[model samples]
Target: MDSPSRRPDRTISAMPQHTPPAPVVNDPATTPSALRRHLARWPTGVAVVTTVVDGRPVGKTINSFHSTSLQPPLVGWCVDHGSSQLDDWLAADGFVVHVLSADQIPLATHFANRSADRFAGIEWTAGLDGMPLLVADVPLRLECRVRHRLPVGDHTYLVGQVVDLTAGPAIPLVLQR
Candidate 1:
């Protein structure tokens, strides 16, 4: 047996050294350009939110449509701040959310154009509160009244309370960046 004082001391240099990992770049994703590009990568269902103002129809193609609640039957979507029809939608008594079918890509494109007449040559019928409901073969339709409006960044978040709904067997249109 070796005496405690006789034991050889282990050199600190013999121990392994761990280097710290490089710090991650704190690039914020909330920037408008970054958000748009990043969010574009995610696929989303397509829809056209329509409302009537002063006896005329107005609508825009939207991919932000989503359900928020079921007990009170709530749904939501966002309109860009630059949209000219924002006031119409905000003042509308109600609006219709027409979930486009997979074959309705042309319709979506038409609505997406800012300078185009969206309702021109399109078939639609007046629904609750005279809101125009696209007559195309959509998979689902929701008639909703304005429930809430929130200003978020460069868009207005519009929450609606569902008043009426219809569903069909058509396949829903999906869009991706």
Candidate 2:
């Protein structure tokens, strides 16, 4: 028989074949389950630290925050040592803390993510210290000037002297394992 329709329209029906490679674990390292267990045991509070750089607002969710000294109105928090945003924060004169209320867990999670526009849909006002203030429901707020910083562990300990503060009637959020 003559070759069927080889002029213009010809069909070659064939199945695409691929090799199935063998599955093997070359390096067995810690898995997500292991990390989850470790992180789960550590409880921390959620605070949104806000500041302005070049007339723009920059904020991040941080749990590693505490009062350093009451006499000088100093407070401290740890930021990842190699964070790209460090330059802006270090250069900025001051920052504000928005102590999330018990019902504002969603706000904490949103700010904590490594995404764009953390201030979107959040009501805030610029404070005298050139920091952003929580205009809505926040249990506490502190505007502080960067006093000192020390490298400790995997983060930079930023100690700030309180320049101004404002507190709301909302309840403070507490995190626990």
Question: Which candidate's lDDT is highest?
Answer: 1
Overall lDDT per candidate, in order of appearance: 0.90, 0.81
Top candidate when judged by TM-score against the true structure? 1
Off by over 4 Å in 2: 1-42
Q: What TM-score against the true fold does each predicted structure earn?
A: 0.82, 0.73
The sequence of per-residue lDDT tens digits that candidate 2 reaches over residues 119-172 is 888888878655788776788888888889788866788898988787879877
For model 1 the TM-score comes to 0.82
Expressed as tens digits, the lDDT of each residue in 1-177 for candidate 1 is: 989899898666555878987765876666778888889999999999999989989999999999999999999999888888888877887789999999999999999888646888899998998899888889999999998999998788999999999999999999888
